[model samples]
Target: MYSISIITVGMNHLAYLKSLLHSLYIENHPKCSFEMIYIDNCSKDDSVKFIRENYPEVKIIENKQPLGFGENNNKGVFASTGKYIAIINPDIVIQKDSLDILLDYAEQHLQAGIIVPQLLNPDHSIQYSVRGFISIKTLTARILSKGKDNVNNKTVNEYLCKDLDFQKTQFVDWAIGAAFFMHRDTFAKLGGFDLDYFLYMEDEDMCLRCWKNNMPVIYCPQSTMIHNHLRGSSKLGKKAWLHIQSIITFFRKHGIKIKNSKEHTMSL
Candidate 1:
């Protein structure tokens, strides 16, 4: 039997955390025994006390100072005793047997260093969780289009890989970090996520490294989960700036040159 570690980092999102915990408790994973590792980033709410009183079985780590997403997750990884780690967000709710399904697929696909399940929106619509590499032009188009569904735009379509049928599992360039799964050895081999990325784009960086190392990053559509889908950067606030900074860091670190390319015709 494989032992799995489900690591989550939280800061003041008590309601979401509670919902996620409830969902995990109700979900079944007959193939694996799992442990929950919760890292509290010095939340202002009563999260610490609540977890202690309600979920005593959980291994909780309290940080005096708030740490970045990469740093906090790294801490949880270090403390984990499982062979596999599932890094998930507080707003995500796993579907019944999703964990077992993911583990089954991972066991079959030995070459895949990372695997992510299909994500659904709260309304049951498919969320485009997996995406191709990011570029300045793609980012600009996404920002300008805003809420007006740019699925028809060439850059946006390519960036989001709108042409593919998400129902069929395939290899993807990267998937959102909201719910990520990987082996402990693979994570350690890559040195985990880069500390330079405070929050956003760390997932992309990790996937890029997997590609560089000739390891596969797979998208498994058989299993699914519901994500509350919070677009923090869409508000164009401090979170947005952090996103842009992470993008710049990603491009610089990968030595990618931003260039304007002629737009192709949009397709469905």
Candidate 2:
């Protein structure tokens, strides 16, 4: 039987976390055994206590100090004992048998090191999770566009791969970190996520490494999940700054340089 470890990092989003947990419990898949692991990032909302009291089956790890996204996930992975580790966000609600579908697809495509499900909005609209490699022009366009629908722009179109049909499963350059499933051995081979990243772009970095190691990063549209995505970084303040910093770090590590653009660019 296949085994999976569902790992999720929590902050102060208690209500969403509870909803996610309920969704997981209700979604049934008899083919595989799974365990839930929650890593609390020292949330002030008593999230750790709530989980322990209500969901005793879930293994909880309380972080004394808040850690970055990659570091918290790594800690969860270390505590997992499943063949596959699923890194999921607190705000995501899993669909019925979604985990089984992803696991089945991953088993069939043994060469794929990482697999991502089709992410849907609460309104049932498709969320474009798969994306192309980030370039200076693409980054500029995304920042300028500010998360609006501007696929008409050439750079934004290419960056978002607007030409591709997301209804079909295919190999992708990378997908969002909102949900990621990887083989234990493959994840270990990549040395987990690079700790240099604080919160953003770590998904892209890991997918890049997967390609370098000759492992395909797959996008599976068969399985779906609803993501309560709040583009927190796009709003303003420290989150936006952290997002920019991660972008710089990713580009620097990959030897890609961002040039100043005089023309107005669109956001993604």
Top candidate when judged by lDDT against the true structure: 2
The collision pairs in model 2 are: 144-267, 145-266, 145-267, 146-267, 147-268
**Tens-digit lDDT track of model 2 for 1-268:** 2389999999998999888988887554425799888999989999988888888989999999999999999999999899998999998999888888989987877877789999998999887777888887777887788856555678888767777688877778888899999899999999999999998999999988887787777788888999998677876789899999998899889868422111213111
Off by over 4 Å in 1: 27-31, 147-151, 257-268
Write the residue-wise lDDT of candidate 1 on 1-268 in tens digits.
2368999999998988888888887544335788889999999999878888888888999999988899999999998998888998988987887777878887777677788899998998888788878776777888878823445788887777777688987778788998888888889988988999997989999888877776777788888999997778777789889988998899989867422111212111
RMSD of 1: 4.6
Cα lDDT of model 2 overall? 0.84
Worst 10 residues of 1 by lDDT: 259-268
Q: What is the C-alpha lDDT of each candidate?
A: 0.82, 0.84
What C-alpha RMSD separates each model from the true structure?
A: 4.6, 5.6
Clashing pairs in 1: none
Clashes per candidate (backbone, < 3 Å) = 0, 5
TM-score of 2: 0.92
* Residue-level error in angstroms, candidate 2, position 55: 1.2
TM-score of each: 0.91, 0.92
The lDDT of model 1 is 0.82
